[model samples]
Target: MLHRLKEFYDGPNKDAKKFYNLVEEANQELYPGCTGFSKLPFTLRLYLLKCLHGWSNKSFTSLLKLLKEAMPELNIPPSYNKTKSTKIDACLNDYILFRNDHKDDDFCHTCGASRYIQSTEVDSELVPSKKQHRVSAKTLRHFPLIPRLKRLFMCSKTADSLRWHEEERSKDRKLRHPADGLA
Candidate 1:
């Protein structure tokens, strides 16, 4: 491992060393005192349960407070905000992704459909002084690929599994795996 680290540091590509450093830093911050592919931390497990059961913020907070009081030694986050995931909204009619250049667009360019649901309750006679709250017509949650891939590679078992084809594949001239047939 030390030899690999040294080679990475002295590699021709500067980004490779930088990426290696970042992965190592992430491993430390994520695992901390834990060793050898342990179970998910209590806080993370609780957060997952909250999300899965759709627990309200008040309920989740109460549970955390109770747990903290009962187990003073355990480190529990005050709220679920610590484990927030990324999400984005998109056009409902055309399914046009609203991001980057089209982030602020109020309507879809392809279908000309409104991005937000039109409020029918608002009275036109009493034009409100402040902007009315708008709800998205539809939402599409997208998980980023890089962070997930980094997490998979961080685990020794998963990393080895990812490279199984290359390291453990039969070298005989026979089509065993699907990839072996690729030109």
Candidate 2:
């Protein structure tokens, strides 16, 4: 199924060819010696399970340590926190996204709301502080889409399934899948 899909993508369509090449490159990086999930290494399988179950880094480390004690030759996988993510401070009142040019701004331009939580301590004659730690009033966590989409095409089974509508769908007048219906 994957071979047929690859052949179809490798045809005259330059965009499809580029997508196939990118997916192949990502697959090589993600699964080096393995072609599919069944052939993946024990450590990789554990890591996938850890990601799927949303296991904490500390919990995963503890599990790996226990596994190492039982199986001395077990290869330790890299940390699960390798995925890139960004946290942006947003306006609490106006719901304005403070990013890029407005990243360093102290207050929201739209609502005139302070970006950081107000300090509650009163100024005293005895104590004088130069700076106070500022916490964002609201934060938005962002995860990149391209890397995640690439991951979806990393596995042969997943890649084949994703392209099923284009590669394996019937060309007749009957509709079998959702892709067959006209929008």
Candidate 3:
């Protein structure tokens, strides 16, 4: 599956507008010292879209070369070590645009952890603990954690988290420490 997908990303497409536009625009301008048309031998627009699909930087270039059909002119972005901020921004924008098109807002997006809340008013007779301990991003403002808890899925840095860790540590200390200090 991975190999097949990689091939598709690097595959040639005569229908690519960006590539044609760049080529046409370059010839019209015919200006020197400017890369109006891609110096790349093959169409990079397809690979650019695929690169946004979240492949590793190395894999992206590897697949690009395959689709480029050995077009030495298919100048994809350089390696991360030599990467420039502007180029990165462009890559990210392309990725975001591609991603946005493929995403469904109504569907369960995997932006963060998955949680389901079920509220049931249990019978007051049988169950003892009436207190609810679970937290949710939806009810974060009501919780003591406030702003920090608002990002429940990514709340490792929250101030209240320290309290929880501290409490757990104390519990461990109790288990480790013997009443008679025999060890």
Q: CA lDDT of 18 in candidate 1?
A: 55
Listing every candidate in turn, what is its Cα RMSD in Å to the true structure after a full C-alpha superposition? 9.1, 12.2, 24.3
lDDT of 3 by residue, 1-183 (tens): 998899679655653654455444323321234344333212234445555787676776566556455644444434432222112111211222112343222222334222324456777677777775432213111112332234353456564565554454455345554432437
The candidate that wins on TM-score is 1
Residue 159 in model 3: shift from native, Å?
55
lDDT of 2 at 68: 60
- Per-model C-alpha lDDT, please? 0.68, 0.65, 0.40
lDDT head-to-head 1 vs 3, winner: 1
lDDT by residue for model 2 (79-170), tens: 43422123568999855878767978999888899999998875665566645679899987543366556669998999999998789889
| Candidate 3 Cα RMSD after full superposition onto the native fold (Å) | 24.3
Each prediction's TM-score versus the true structure: 0.47, 0.36, 0.20
| Candidate 1 residue-wise lDDT, 35-143, digit = tens | 5422224545676888899999789988987976886644545555543322356888756878767889999999988988998776756876756798888887443
Off by over 4 Å in 2: 1-86, 93-95, 99-101, 122-131, 155-183
**Clashes in model 3: which pairs?**
10-67, 40-73, 40-74, 41-73, 41-74
What lDDT does candidate 2 reach at residue 132?
Answer: 62
Ranking by lDDT: 1, 2, 3
* Pick by TM-score: 1 or 3, better one: 1
